[model samples]
Target: MRYIHTIKPLGNRRLLAGSCMLILLPLFFLCFTQTARAGKDPNILFNGCQVLFQGEKPYIDQNNCTQVPADFAADYLGAVISQDTSQKTISITKGDTGIILWTEEKKALVNGREVSPDSGAVNRNGTVMVPLRLVCETLGSGVEWVAETKTIRVTLDNGYILPESTCLSIIAPPPGNPDKIGLSILLFLDRDLDKQYDDIHFIMTGIFDTIQADEIVKHIGQKKTPKDNLPYRKWVRDDRAVTAGSEPGDSSISIIIWETGG
Candidate 1:
């Protein structure tokens, strides 16, 4: 950013300098526009891990809506995205939900239904910037905009977004329906709250890198794998049974705990 100017012949050089400054003025404005267009890069945490954006980073627009890279956001949201440069169109689909939008257009298609919003995806220096909320909400994903920190947190339905080094557990029949026992409810638990349960049957989820199965094993006293090679490992402590596992392809882990004795 440091500039060096060499002194030359006094009279004609002064006039030449003025002419050069005029030419560089437009170039300076272009640089400023590029930087300001993206606004600021608020940290985006997808599934408890900060997403590293390549080329153009995610930023907040003037309207306070988040704009993100098309491919990156599609992958994180578990949606398949197809782009047509010639048409300036983007199509994102997850399960039965479908979303289609064009660059620089506020009109978007959700499940073949047309709706116009404030602003849609736009092309930024060859990178297609899509509105994070518009697409995520249509696909049934969680989008949290933290105004204080200016950060965005996203969670997809396929997996749970968990806190670092901690698991969020929730007992089955969740509070009101305590009488509905022995019910197997698969929950993608993402929060922690005080709950009362006379009989324990809880499901938990957390990040693997920040917290592993070993951390939960201690709370359940000791674990033992049956010599007969049972389908699942045994975890025992204070008449309680706990089992924790993670998918080989996923970064999150799931734990199920239940009371072994009444």
Candidate 2:
């Protein structure tokens, strides 16, 4: 007579381990693929953009102007020319190309070769068109164009995230005394209400080192109150004191500290 035999299938721990391996194996392969493809795409960041003309005026007239600096003159481009006193949106044109703008420092792969852009400019029509090959190489954002979509997909470097477009405003400390406690204030327009710090405005207040006093005063102006009675050094409207930039729909203002001493 044949005897009936019973066999145990598998333990939960063994099954779990096998399942984990199954999930991890594909993830490993995916990571390898991404690394290999990383060589093809480069990541790029926008530091700053501006327009320059023969007269040396960066942005002239509210409307008509000559020569704009942006990321790309065609396709994808962002302009630095301040559209208004608030300096919210840099003039962006669609279908323009070859603009110049500054970018963060890093090596990127473009068309299989590495490249960098000390600065670049954009064109009219607001299309940020750059030397596709160069910008892609420097930013390490895989540069690929799809005719069907008429779009450029820039795959950023792994672990890289776009910075929140925010303004940096700094208020310097009082004159003389570098070691004194200072105040650095940041103000941003809460658009999303998420409180993630979308836009930034900085105001720094404290004692200033004697050597830096003159330069600080020159840029931001003298304190509204007396040197001894000054309530945090006041900010003046000087070319150097205030810097403006653009955001999607909002504006930004920055106040930088020049010195510590009065």
Candidate 3:
């Protein structure tokens, strides 16, 4: 036995908290569809924590750059933000990675690597607004914009994704599932739930449409764990069992997750 216990995620995988197992097909990971907000002011969630701005709320420009105050950006990124008032530059530093932006330029120097994303830092009124999506992703955090309520949800590497209730707010919540933290994003696209659970094994069923599955994963910024193994594919995070699976030649995604306790 070579003990092939792990299959690398095609990209950054945002598996929620706890250990889970999946018996899955060979998934093809494609360019993840980016979330966008239309013409609406967006509320922000940072690592499951709601961000409170002093006076200005988050604004998505026509260029689709989610801009926030420099101070708030510093707080959200846990970085030190400094300004060059004379030269009109803002330097945001986290660990060894440094990013420098200017109020008049869309170009930025990320650790001496010059790059630009959509738009750049802007001085609106007396406050310097920073391009949040660019900065957050630069710092290695996953960003998802919920167009329904015009919300920005962030998943930091040091933090888990949105909590159960918040996640349910983004996805369809079932009528009667025992609110498991990880299961909040599991299960199906849309269905009524009448589940029975007493001990070890738990099961539920959903009409699995591959496109819908991809859409669900995209909506929440999660990629399905892929493996060459046809029927048995496993992608679990930490240390508890919660999984989804389906049978061969079947169009159903069955939910099968368990834990030690009842």
Candidate 4:
């Protein structure tokens, strides 16, 4: 996969350490409405995750810019949207930031400053669709298009995205090892956990919502191997403490180990 990292001074972006294994299990539960095909169809991703559109799916307009339903920003980014039918204008507000756009206009007012969107706002099928990049940028988020997958990853403050690590390696014992059986997967990222909090909490949000650090520890502790005829212990064990801290640095790697017997 071709991945690009874009960083800007977005008011001190902070990194937090956590496991995203929860994201893998819940993929079965999500409902995919459709896929992005050519320019007629488009899929919207929120915070590097696919969004489940309720009504009209997103589409690319004549301007070659992706447009989404008016309420999409409100639902995903917590932005409040309001429209004036008589004036053909729309307004959005999040925290101290305010954005104003006109129906079929190419310029938007960001916090009282006029800015041109990659594409103007247009009303389609009674739904006001605006440029995807415009909405995200106005809301303090970054949008990246992955042409290989036809997917867009919109991250807040350029936060970490899925396939979390750029480099991954797995090591396992050869099959039929009489003395021991073990496996280890190392996931590495290009950045470090900001400040390295001592009591760092692991909150996995994505496929699943934010999970508490304590819950993860308990889940690992309760894991039991299935009963079988094999002489090895039922459960696998690893040296990792459910709660661990990162070293002081900009790069980080997490090694997760699973073992059956020794």
- Measured by TM-score, the strongest candidate is 1
Ranking by lDDT: 1, 3, 4, 2
TM-score, one value per model: 0.50, 0.20, 0.48, 0.50
lDDT of 2 by residue, 1-262 (tens): 1111111121211000001111111111111122222213222222111111221212211111112223232212211122221322222221111112322222222222223432233333433222343433232334443334322333323221232322222222222224331323222332221221222211111222333334433332322212212123344333113222223333221233333333
What is model 1's C-alpha RMSD?
19.7
Model 3 weakest 10-residue run by lDDT: 1-10
lDDT to native, each model: 0.48, 0.25, 0.47, 0.46
lDDT of 1 by residue, 105-210 (tens): 7777666666765568989888778887677666655667555666666654433333331122221221122232211211122222122111122223232221
* Candidate 2 residue spans exceeding 4 A from truth: 1-130, 139-190, 193-262
After best superposition, candidate 4 residue 237: deviation in angstroms?
30
Residues 1-262 of candidate 3 have per-residue lDDT tens digits of 1111111111221211211222212111111124554344677775444665665556776676777777654444445667778999888765555677889677777777666556778887777788876676665556776666666776654223233222121221211224432232232223212211100111111222344334333322222222211243333323434344544443324333333133
Q: By lDDT, is 3 or 4 better? A: 3
Superposed model 4: Cα runs more than 4 Å off: 1-38, 158-201, 204-212, 215-262
lDDT of 4 at 62: 59
